[model samples]
Target: MLHQEKISVRQFTILVFMYTLGTSVIYLPSLVASYGKENGWISVLGSSLIGFGVVFILNKIAQLDEKKHLFELLEFIFGKWIGRIISVLILMFVIYLLATNLRQIGDFITTQVMVQTPIYVIMIIFILVSLFAVKLGLEVIGRTSEIFFPYALFSLILLIVLVAPQADFSNIQPLFRENIAGAFLAVFPASEVPYFQLFVFLAIFPSVNKPDKAKKGFYIGVALGSFILFIITFMALMVLGPDFTARNQYPTYILGKKISIAEFIERIEILVAIAWFFSIFFKLTINFYALSLGVSYLLKLKSVQTLTTPIAFFVVILGIILFPNIIYFMDFSQFYWPFFAITFGLFIPLLMLLIGMIKKRKQGNGSQTPS
Candidate 1:
């Protein structure tokens, strides 16, 4: 297969942050609040720590196999049969994540903004756009993120500023009253998913222009993205308070709705929606690229482009099946999926890193000459 072109370290970081932030920014506060209540922000902080650790594990693996993607590294570490099996599992998990994210975006748009539009229409449009982006390959997606990420960040800052008038500092009061366990539990879904999802970026790490900078870029992106999410969560809580933020499905959207510049410039929710759509667009593109790359590697295809359409179609179908309704998606994500994601994204990569290191050491020790 023709290799994808390399992307700059800046572009790589943008791709990681934009993909990680995405649609989660809209609904995450509510999900976190569900588990955390007044302690939701704590969950956000806790999740950031978990995410940092996951990035460290992934970076170690990337450093060890600077010239290869995760699939090749797995093959080298475990041999073909077992490696391919593990790759298949990872591929399936990625596909599921892509579908879930796409469906959530589609559902969000339909439910909140375009009640009349069919959800399938939104899903198909995004899938097709993502397919086109994937066909263009990783460079294009990375560059696209570099462009959109700034606007996304700007929109976030704008929302926070606009909502400042409504924020009540007392909303998040009684801090640490929930104890350590409650704080950790709240962080489970909020920070974990955003930070851990970067694992899939392993597919593109080999294509980074400065491979050594991958770790720095990855962590910077995560820290910056988490800080943004944290601020958003804080603003949402401060503005809406726990009771309201918890009940609202999209606290960020509501924050936008509450923004009023002299009362004449109200109803700026459209701006917020546009920013969110762009964020989710980059996100879906990256996920689609990863899925295409994984399939191409598994089948040993001459080009990753060939799998784009097939996978896009499958994603649309999967989006429809995997989320019959928003509630089901929310329940699965909050209650069950975070643990599964932790296992696949964090624990498994750490295990591979340890095993790869030990195997390399043993081989090194055994290969010494008679000297």
Candidate 2:
């Protein structure tokens, strides 16, 4: 059966905020710095505006029929066959997205923390935790986000403040080092992972108990997410320099390592790691929930939570097989994934909005016609 669960506006806001931070906090600095160099901050500022537009488009699509979600609207607007085909494509993309994220956490833990532990072992543990959340449904997920959000926010803020003294403003000077075009180029890679990938929220929008407040919350969440991204990017460049930031896979983690206040408080990269874990955990939970829920809706299943186990098994396999190593993953993300993301993130939702508007106009004309 379709779920009747509802999350408060506050819960929804936190979900969006945490979701926007997602995997971007740790990896985006390197990704953007590699392209924009000292101008990575510029790219972040530019892309966040695009992110706002994207949120507007996604919300418009979701609002087309307040009661029907993205999946049902696909069928309603496109007819059964085309809609189902599109649904299958989106669902497949979600699966891959989930696997990519799972693989990221897996690689991070194995390489950085667990050392000798095999990657798959880490993947299994993380996926199982997310799968447990998926089984519990979005209400639990939203509530959990609320509980952890305060700590995540506080810890992240502490990290930034502690590292602030290390920042060398000179490192960010000579702005637009790559000229305007290169900085603009950086925005593309910077935009894809965090902003475009947020199409997942379209599926969850209808679950918010307060639609009006949730709309405001969506804008707030995106703005806050983009701001945090900018601060982290700017800080990374100033403290570590663009080369160091770009070269290091997890520059934010290194910023944590740089924290030495009187040498009394040191090696607190754990704070960054812990805060990241909360964001990624929620990210994985939301992605997995979307995957399982999308599958249930596509198959016309009665219950949304039924497919968590079997689907997660495939994700674990793909999480391992899809990414051979960090090099391949980074290259794919920079070179190909941005375009891959917009296909769903921008074009699909834009298509939905246009088609939905057209349909509404036609219906209005039909209603006015004499019987």
Candidate 3:
């Protein structure tokens, strides 16, 4: 595939940061707190460390063939038949990811702010908006991330400061009450969903204008995004306490509701929620972009843009079916999603790397033949 448009290193970094923050801000804090309790911060740190490792793996794989997108690299390294199978699995995962995110945000809005609105209505509208963004091309998505960067930052900082007065260090007293095993279990979900899912970025990595700087962009983006997540999880524990944090489906939203001033300032939860909404929009757009791109590549289509609408419509329909209710969504997210993530996010990439190395070695030996 031709690299027709390119995003600068800065833009790429911004996209990474936003994408990492996307689903994490709302969902992860509660999930981690539920498992690790007062030790949730440890789980957050553990997840971040694992996330960094995943980023390193992805960046190295991208380096293996700096010129080719991930799908092409798979085909190049694994041959046509196997590569097509891997590509199909990855494509399916991205679409499922897109659907879950759409379902998540839809659930959030209907349950919290839009009590009168239908859930499907919310999901469809959000899907349409994100689909339009994906249709504009990756360059546009990159630039859009730059514009949203400051807003996300400001809202995050503002929320932390606003909620600081409610902090109780005592809530986290007697650390490791559940011991290391519980925190370790929590770490898997925390890391897997937001961080490891970055595997999809391999599809987008070749679009970086400065291919050499791509590694730097990936590191900076993941570091910054994960740090923010750590802070949010810490704050949720400190302010809400682990019990309250875990009980509420959207702990961060409740955290938002707690942002009260002496008398006048209040009810800015919606404003804070917008930050998550914007971040998830970028996440959905990029994932949808990757899905469309993968499909076009597999089918030998001339342009990925051609399939955007049809794929997006399918995503909306699939989103409706994936989660019948919030209970099932949360159950899948907690119990099943991490393993599913590992299959595509961890195992597949590692297999590709191992196979890629073998292929390179064979080619090297062939070139040294006496004939």
Candidate 4:
């Protein structure tokens, strides 16, 4: 296999930024408010710090052998059988992530946009478009993002600007005086959603054209994305109040609906919704890329093109059954997912770094091949 699909570090950075904002932009304000109350923005800061550490850890893992895919590197660090076991475990998480993101798009469209469309129909259409993006290959996905990513940012900035005037400083009053533990507790939950899932990039790290710059890009993207998330959360609390923001499933969307500039700019939420669609689409595309490639590696397949369809079908099925209801989904994301995320996000990466560093020392330590 030639393994020739390469993406620029710039594009890699863009993907990271967009992926970080994906669904978090739509749902994070409420999640944070439920936990952190008035200090949700502070929680975003704590999460961003943790995000920096995550990037550093994953960057070290990639440097273990920038030429090898994540599965190959795992096998080198843990040997054949254990590595395969770990790979399967990681892919299971990947499937859950893919299914959840797909389910989100499905639910959002049906409930918020169309109001009458079947969820399955929405999931199917979304998966098909994402399937095409993934099958076209990573480079194509990267380039397509280059073309459309700006509008997402522009809309996002406009969202922030328009929503800023309505903010009430008293809504976020007391300045971290109440329920401070809740604010600290909110850190992991905020970080877990986007920061933890970044390991998906390991599957495609070997495809980066410039490893050094791509590493920087990862950090920059996380910083920027977390800042964006913080601003959104702050505005949501200031504009909607903590109680209202906490109860709403999609505070960011509601913020959009409230963007009435002199009463003339009414209901441009659909325009803002376009930005959400793009962000989530790119996130799904990158994640499905990892899922397809990981499965291909697990199955020892030479090509993943044909595998994409069946895998997408499986995702749709899991998306349907994964959550009995959105309430269950939100509960899982809030109360339980932080613990689940750390196993792969922190534990596995740290384990690999420890073992790989030990192995490198034993082999004279100049980035030589293990075994």
Local error of candidate 2 at residue 162 (angstroms): 0.5
* Colliding pairs, model 1: 1-302, 43-187
Q: 292-336 in candidate 2: lDDT tens per residue?
A: 778899878998888889988889999999978888997898899
How would you order the candidates by TM-score, starting with the best? 2, 3, 4, 1
Which regions of candidate 2 deviate over 4 angstroms? 177-179
Question: Which ranges in model 1 have alpha carbons more than 4 Å from their true place?
Answer: 1-4, 178-180
lDDT winner: 4
RMSD of each: 1.5, 1.1, 1.3, 2.1
Candidate 1 clash figure, as a count: 2
Tens-digit lDDT track of model 1 for 77-149:
8889998999999888889888988888788889889999999899999888888888888788877877777
TM-score for each candidate, following the candidate numbering: 0.96, 0.98, 0.97, 0.97
Sort by lDDT, top down from the best: 4, 3, 2, 1
The C-alpha local distance difference test score for the whole of candidate 2 amounts to 0.87
Give lDDT: candidate 4, residue 256. Answer: 89
Give the per-residue lDDT digits (tens) of candidate 3, residues 108-187. 88889989998889988998988788778888888888898999889988999999998999988788655568788888
lDDT of each: 0.82, 0.87, 0.88, 0.89
Error of 3 at 120 (Å): 1.9
Indicate the worst ten consecutive residues by lDDT in candidate 1: 178-187
In candidate 3 the C-alpha lDDT for residue 88 amounts to 93
Which segments of model 4 are wrong by more than 4 Å? Answer: 365-371
